[model samples]
Target: MFPDTPVTSAALSVATRFCSPALLNHCVRSYLWGVMYGGAHGIAFDDELFCVAALLHDIGLTDAFDSHRLPFEDAGGRLAWVFAVAAGWPQERAARAHEIIVLHMRDDVPAADDPEAHLLQVATSWEVVGRHAEEFPARARADVLTRYPRLGFGAEFLGCFEDQARRKPDSAAAASVRRNVAGKIAANPLETHQG
Candidate 1:
């Protein structure tokens, strides 16, 4: 379960409204993965901040929030910043949400510098391409997957990134496409594991 605050609730509402079924599951699973990883690793982070960030991290990938020029993560960060401010968060805290959301797309967020961002980055990567998948307990992974399910997320996510890359060739998504991330997603061990 995630934080039950009004802000967190609003984040989930936005996700449910805009995201495809598979994308919504990916967002939720990323949060669950982050929480479980934080608990297992003793890395402390604000649950509310982390949960809201995770739920809205992929908002820019949705039709409602996608941008023609900006990277999806950057667009999504601004959207999340507005949502946080509207939910009565202080500007500083709202900025933190923006930071976490924007940083989730990066590969090198240091946990000591930004635990929530670091966790979100790793968790989302684990959910998508199975990076760091072996670090999480198999049982926890099974339960989360059972509740949310992959639901063809691999192909769906690859399509999203591919589209983003085509639209914004200078974006991080384009870089991912250049790296053949689609192949990696398809061959992910976590996606094929029977746990």
Candidate 2:
């Protein structure tokens, strides 16, 4: 039940242009998981905003924006801000979208105050780290993975993170890379699936 608004379509198109198929699928799955998670938890959120945030959350990992000194999350949030403004979204909504992108990486996101941001954080974590699997329904998880196959996402995404760490040594990516690159790579949720 992803939003199909023009802005959502444009966001997806932009993401598809920049991201690999695996990353693109991850983005879509993040949105799906966010929506499902929110609905299951009775959290009211703006679906379009969540969709845009999810789709563009990893944009900085792409080649075009990867060169920036900012952490991938900040770079992606900036890019999302610009995209939202250009798409005629009001300043407040644009900022909210930006916040959602930027804060998705934090471990302690305040979900009660901003459900969209919370959902994005949880969804991204779930997609990347396989956390919170028990919170969501099994059927929804299967449906999402079926719709958006991992396609070796673990290797591809870890490679991207490693490259980011190499290029932006002072960034959060580098810190994460240094902390436990092998463990994180091995722990990727997509690595378990052969299909």
Output the number of the lDDT-best candidate.
Answer: 1
- On residues 1-195, what C-alpha lDDT tens digit does candidate 1 reach at each position? 878788899899999999999999999999999998888899999999999999999999999999998899999999999999999999999999888988888767888999999999889888877788678877887888889998889989999999999999998889999999998898776677554
TM-score of model 1 relative to the true fold?
Answer: 0.97
TM-scores of the models, in the order given:
0.97, 0.91
**Tens-digit lDDT track of model 2 for 1-195:** 567699999999999999999999999988888888888888988889999999999998888876456889898998999999999999889998889888887655776888888999888777766678677666666667788988888778878888888878887667767878557557754456422
Q: List the residue pairs that clash in candidate 2.
A: none
Each model's lDDT comes to: 0.89, 0.83
TM-score for candidate 2, please give it.
Answer: 0.91
**Deviation from truth (RMSD, Å), model 1:** 1.0
The CA lDDT at 12 in model 2 is 94
